[model samples]
Target: MAGLITILIDGITYASWLFIVALGLTLVFGVLKILNIAHGSFYALGAYAAASFVGWAASMKWAPGLSLVAMLLAAVAVAALVAPLTERGLLRFFYGRDEVLLVLVTYAMFLIMEDVTKLVWGANPYYVSEPYSLFGNVDVGKQSYVGYDFALVGLAAVVGSAVWWGLNRTRIGKIVTVVIHSSEIAASMGINVSRVYMGAFAVGIFLAAIGGAFTAPMISVQPGVSVGVIIVSFAVVIIGGLGSIEGAAVGALIVGLARSIAVHTAPVAELFSIYIVMAIVLMFRPEGLFQRIQARKI
Candidate 1:
């Protein structure tokens, strides 16, 4: 029972990380109707930025727990700088184009960003563990673990709830939902689709970046980390029903728990476990479990 509880807590932490990355991807797709492959790049950039800033902050004479704050700011700054330029300058050109074309553009952007990162930060991996270390430790049974890990679970819950409230219970969220349903209609109703697109894209990037920043304390900031994050984030988005926030949350939980279980029950199939569940879900509900919007006959 104790082991199971530990596993569950671990799963929650993993899910939170997944949510941080996937939420942005889901929102970009939900609002802009485009799958930004650059989502992963944004996350990578955030991690890199956070790592750099936190490292600098640590070397300086600063207060305790400041590095984590630096991490958050670094992520937001990166998103603020990158998201607007990418969305308005690059992604805007392909707004009304085919989905594949937009994805291709974002993929190309991701490639360019990869090279750019190499130029800026070199090829060496970087890391910062202040956030984890600051949270100290907690004792459970005969085990002692970082308190930050458990705190991260609570933080993830707060973020998820806040995002849900922002999307469902707020005026801007309602607007965003309407735009997602039909951008054309939303525009016709006097909404500025361009502004909406930029805002949504920025917010998405913001979430992804923050996720990276959060993980900077634990995960190594490697050049290719973005690649895995992109893949896993895509799976989370698809499993969660493309544009559904609730689906994203549930999907993260499902994938995280499955991965946790696989580690103990079937290590050989750990990688395939998620895809198997996704395939099963897709087979029964092609449009997704929570998707209520129906397609019309063309």
Candidate 2:
């Protein structure tokens, strides 16, 4: 029973951060119709930025609790600075181009950002371990867990609820939804689709960055961190159905539990467990567990 509880807690904790990242990926795909191979790069930037920001905060002798604020600011800064440059300066030009072309473009951007991160932060790993103990520890029955992990679970819940409420209950969200359905029609209605596109992209990048920010303390902030995240995030969105908020959530839980189980039971299968589950899901539901099959428009 204790072992089962540990697995469940570990799975939920892992799913929390993943859901945050995958939510952004799905949002970008839903609104902009771009798969955004560079999304993981933004996540890396967030971690690097968080490491810098939190370090600065510590140097200033700020309360350790405020490191959380620094991490959040890091995410906001990345979104504010990078989103415009990527969306307007580069991706906008490729609008209406072939989807394959867009994918290649984003892949190129990913490669470029990989080099850029090394150039700025260098190849050395950065650590933000200070924030990891902010929440101290929580005892769960016979097992003990980091309080920070439970905090992440709460944060994920808040993020998901906020995004859902914004999209379903707000005027701008309705406009964005219309644009998602038919950007041309929305533009004809004087909705300013370009601005909507930029807004959605910024929000998506913010989600990715925030995921990285919080996760910085949990792992080494270094080059190649984005690679693993990108692979798993893609798996999540694919399993949940691209562009689906609910799908992202469910997919993350499934992946997280699968990985946790593998790690606890069969360490050798840890790497393949996620992919195996993804393959099985794809076999049974190619459109994903949540995505409906839409009739092709003439």
Candidate 3:
């Protein structure tokens, strides 16, 4: 039983990581309908940037706990600057176009950004140990693991709740939510959807950055690390229902736990576990597990 509990914890932590990376992707896709390949670039950039910042802090003898703030700041800084620029300068031209073209363009942008990473950071693996040391470890039954991993689960839950509240409670989040459901209606009502879209993209990018930053200290930060998660994350987003924040959280936990089981019982099944669920879900319930309910407007 202890072994099972340990595996479950491992799965949840992995799921949290998946949710953190995927939530932003779903938000952008929900709002823009672009299916951005550049989303992966942000993830990669975030990881690299976080690794760099944390490494610098450690070398300077700063507290490892402070690296968390630095990681978030780096992500926010990158998103604050890059989001508007990308939305206006490049992505704007492709608005309301074919999905395939938008995809090609974003992939081109992703390629360019990937090269930029190489140019800026070089092609080497960077790791941040501050986060690991800060939380230290815990003995879950017999196995010892990083407490930061559990902390990440809590953080992802908070982020998920905050995003849900943002969408339902805040004016800005409402506008963005409107944009997600119907941009035409939003614009017809003089909502200034263009700005909203930019802001949404910025938030999406910021989340991606934060995911990278958070994971950097726990995992190896390399140029291609973003590529590693992009596919699996898409699966999580799809399984959780597209453009659904709650769905993303739920989906991550599912995939994380499933993969954990596979890791222990059937190693070969780990890679395909998510896809199996994706196929099953898409085949039956196209809208996903949680369908929005709206009352009649009499």
**Clash counts for all predictions:** 0, 0, 0
lDDT of each: 0.85, 0.96, 0.84
Question: Using lDDT as the measure, which candidate wins?
Answer: 2
Candidate of highest TM-score? 2
- Sort every candidate by lDDT, greatest first: 2, 1, 3
Looking at model 1, residue 270 earns an lDDT score of: 83
**For residues 1-298, could you state the per-residue lDDT of candidate 2 as single tens digits?**
9989988999999999999999999999999999999999999999999999999999999999999999999999999999999999999999889999999999999999999999999999999999999899999897889999999999999999999999999999999999999999999999999999999999999999999999999999999999999999999999999989999999999999999999999989987999999999999999999999899977
Q: Tens digit of lDDT per residue, candidate 1, span 103-157?
A: 8898999999999989999999886877778888898776777888777777678
Stretches of model 1 off by over 4 angstroms after superposition: none
What does the lDDT read for residue 212 in candidate 1?
Answer: 87
Candidate 2: segments with Cα more than 4 A from true spot: none
lDDT of 3: 0.84
Model 3, 1-298: lDDT tens digits are: 9879978988999998789889999988888887877887898888888887877777888876788888888898789878978999999888989889999998898889989999999998887876777778888777898889988888888877887898889988878878877888998999998888888888889888888888887787887887868888888887888788888888888889888988988889988887887888888877676545446545
Minimal lDDT window, size 10, model 3: 289-298
